[model samples]
Target: MITINEAYVDSLALNAAAVKNGRDLVKKNKITKRCRTEDKTLLFGDCQGSGKEPYRCSVDYLKPESPVYRCTCPSRQFPCKHILGLLYASAAGQTFSVEAIPQEIAEKRDKADKREEKKKEAIGVGSDEAAVPKRKTNKAALAKKINAQLEGVELLDKLIRQLVQNGVAGIDSKVLKMMDDQAKQLGNFYVPGLQNELRELILLIKENKDSESLYTEAMDQLTYLHALLRKSRDYLTSRKQNPELAMDSESGLEESIGHAWQLSELRDYGRVQAHVELAQLAFRSNLYAARSEYVDEGLWMDLSSGSLYVTRHYRPVKAAKYMKEEDSVFDIVKASELFIYPGELNPRVRWDDGPLRSMQAEDLERIHSYSRSSFTEVIKLVKNQLKNPLSDKHPVVLLRYSEIVVGEDDSYGLLDAQGKQIVLQDTAYLAHATTHLLPLLTPELAANQAMLVLFEHELSSGRLIAQPLSLVTKREIIRFIY
Candidate 1:
């Protein structure tokens, strides 16, 4: 009777195997004799099991974000397959006849409601006198925690200053030991992001030892790390002075420096729930602490808001079963609404809910309009981001490149209508781009025509290097990340 607006079934399963098994059970008509509501606040069903008496499965959807599941089954897995099947069946639009709340279900709902009421009461919702003291206590505790974190930030600042003064060459012999010490210190301070950065720096140094551009790469990372430390310290100081200001703005620098926000906090602080289309998704592998780590980097475009969002999923490389297949990145996922996390110029988001759908012509047009920018505009944007010092990887659209030039040493450069050029940092990226863009050009077209491109770029030492996302000609768009 109740319309199911959202389904948390997929997210609730313990593992991928459980999800598949649960969905399989539902498809085989295993769940039968159910009761549901129009709001889908409650769902109970009988799922035929191996025994004669069916398993009684119930889901209390009173809290849509975190549904409570209960099933009379012997499965060790939480919720088990029956619970998943029931929820899946509801999400699939299978109608259930409205029925009176059974005695057992009614008791459980009443208990839940009472507990929530008590929680509100304990927070002094019914009495203003108790609320003031509770607020003060919470504020004091938060202040203490922030002050402790500030001490850690101060330590990090000192280490960064030393690194800058000594230079990469000075630390080359002891780089591994230095990184290990710094990472351990960062871990002590609960700065996981900085720790990860240190690990990445070590990996770069080790892998690129024989490369000609090793110094450039090392200095780039060191400078970025120094800037990050400075920004984090400044922000923490400001946050300490005005706690209210911290609540109002997104902690971009803080997050970049290893502060993490919970999913609940993100949901509450999100700016919008909008539909997004996937533009590019790739799996990048790297070494950390002598082990391989994998990260799924997904670039998504918000159709309504016209903003780009980055979604990342990280796992140990050894967990092959849990990792996404590289080729499967191109598979069409249904269009769904996402909770857009807060950011000033660029936002990050995660999937909220929706059915899978194919990208349409109108969707493409909207995305292009939102993302397209002239080369001059791109430069201006990068300049603005560079002002922050700690900001990295700003996505931009470069429109109408008059020429794609192959520079000395096989480097790639693109010239815009204004005669301004932006070069790519990687020679391989240039080779790949030339292969694709060259085929689309004829002798006359190569001489006179221009093409549009989308790229995520970084500013290093006053130079802008493009990391190509897509190359768009009059007839087709070829994505580089995929």
Candidate 2:
């Protein structure tokens, strides 16, 4: 009759530090029955991996003041998976009801009791059975899980090696398709972190232009994958040869410190290709006529190396209110240099136009529509605007701005100026929208040039949308703990 908080379960899922440790034990198969009774205790179960046979380990929560673990398993990793699983179970409100001991075990307990009784009688009635202790028994459940996990690592390693051998462009479509399927399988197994790592590797290779650098990176991933595979194989081999003997060993039941890996470390820049500026300006001139301010910036951070990259995505922000009857400070004038990226925050600018305190009703609508277009669409649209302010239905205008950089291996990432990294590797199709603002970019307005102007028109009114995009850098890579 122990009560567990639901929030604790959520914390367990999100807890970066704890999840790694817990996952390791799960992979090793050292945890079996996680019990949540009056005291959160773990009942040692059969182990199936490498270790001394007949391992004995249990968390005793019978006493809240001083909870302790009773285990014959050796090595000094305290409160191992047996304890962690028990806690997790309790937090999840999973009630533990001790099962009936099997007949054979019951008989053994009875015989032991008789022997202890006889000894107590020989000594004194008050004498206890302290001389006889519970014997350690081989665990069976854990071994099975360990064997399976090892197999998965092996398969993944082989797959990655094969992909690398095939070359970048060659493996691009096929490997990504395979990864998509593999990710689904891994997700079903509750190993999302592992899935993310694999995705990150694929993404890197996909985005790489240099075959040599890609091969090098692929080799590094191969190393890690191989190590994981080896560990799993070792665990499986131990269990198959002498399941009982291995379980009895302390190593069999105890949690192991995983191999040291630098998570979120980014490889060196492989290659860079300059963008081609279009020949003929397809944008209409009227697009920027009632405009105010525009800004777009890109930021990237490599988590492991503490590297950063910043790029810009620029677009004009339309004035809030455009009054057609009055003269305005802002006019249709093309600004230099524009870039675009995925994921950004709103960075809207506002200002006052000539003779008008705010924007007109019609001007506002035009500005709002301008704010909704995606960077690519916005740029082309703006170009059209600069060229012909009056032309409607531009070729690129109706073409749903839904194109993503095809076969991109490396998606953009972000890290704050403080070096905090956030990676967005598995990018799905980012649908075309009016305008989506990224957070990392700097707004185009400066001290001397205030573009976010509001023109007070007799009629038109609307709001302009702004967003900031940050460039990816080496330091913004996120690390994963195994």
Candidate 3:
């Protein structure tokens, strides 16, 4: 059974209104109308704007269910809202008698329960043995995949450019066929995002829809892939190329924390960073903001000794004790491990707020660590920033009352500490979570920790590492005399 909160209900109602609006506009084009509703789920309808038949979809409201409405109305947007309204109506207090779970749903639930049980058992089984290695995708297989993707992307790019050059009327079934094939390839390869964009582009061209928006999005993707090609080549030859090749020309302290400075100007930024990136925290009962200049690209910090320096990614060491054997596959999830980039370059900050939101989850999991009180403190700081967003006085600066100990080689070290060295595992329970650290409670933090660490590949082992250099709180102080 799923519980619905009052706020969620209100949101659904609002969404339903939007869907209703969408339904009205879409129907104006004189397309066929269709409505659908699901038991314990959502409702939606659509009308054709093109010569084709109208598309309609709906999903039932079930626990942990995905988007209910699926449509082929040539819209890249999800749920197409006509469907959302019906679902919202159903959820916003309608009488639909409940019945026993369907056999298929019940069977799915049972299977899920069994899988969870196995995971738990593995966790408790202890480290008498390491689990089997996951299957690796071979290089030949990888090249073939990459090559296919390259072909699809190239074709899409060429199709759009050709459309822009020749005009919409010039488009023929052959061009449409090629675009459709590219879209299908992206979809088959699990790139629904690209697929959706391609669909939207096709519809826009066919209907003479918003030309400007389509052009902008298409260009954005084209530019991103172009840059990715260079980065991919650099990654392939990392051993031979200088480390600086991996870092973009945009690497610098000014660029790294520019967003942080912008945050200080806010009156109430809200947990934008939390919503945007990941952060590691230290537990602190006291409230304060901290600041420090970001020094260099791979400065290694001794978690035990409290020293900082540039270090490579693969400085082979044992896993943290808290790393359950079952969790070993996810190396980044290990708590309080420090790594640094040895080269002058900094890996670009990949933000979820935009396209190419994050790196591999396992990569992120490997660099994870928790603060005893830091997690709570960080969350509070973030929530405050999200809500307040601004202050008249200089933004708050937090300080570390203690040092963060790094777990390594059969031994432990205190990293980049300006205070007493303490073991984080002893102080706080590490969980798979993300956070942000900054000087302002009102302004959003620039970049949270995880990817900040993962972006910088470690040199020695050709693996990944995350290391913290320093902390400080920056504020523009003012004097008011009475």
Candidate 2 lDDT, 256-284, residue by residue in tens = 11221111100011111122111110111
Tell me the tens digit of each residue's lDDT in model 3 across 158-272: 6556666776556578887877776666654423334545665565456554656545544443444344333433433442333222222222222221112122111121111
How do the residues 92-178 of candidate 1 rate in per-residue lDDT, one tens digit apiece?
888788876678987988898899798656554445353133332365666776676777767766766777788766666576687
In order of TM-score, best first, we have 1, 3, 2
All candidates in order of lDDT, best leading: 1, 2, 3
Give candidate 1 misplaced runs (Cα > 4 Å).
1-137, 172-175, 248-251, 263-270, 273-293, 316-338, 342-345, 371-373, 394-463, 471-478
What are the runs in model 3 whose C-alpha is more than 4 Å off?
Answer: 3-57, 65-75, 97-133, 141-235, 238-482
lDDT of each: 0.61, 0.34, 0.34
Models, CA RMSD each: 7.4, 27.2, 20.9
lDDT of 3 at 122: 48
225, model 3: CA deviation in Å?
Answer: 17
- In candidate 2, which residue ranges exceed 4 Å CA deviation? 1-138, 187-197, 207-210, 244-482
Clashing pairs in 1: 1-38, 2-37, 2-38, 3-38, 334-356, 334-357, 335-357
Point out the higher-scoring one by TM-score: 2 or 3: 3
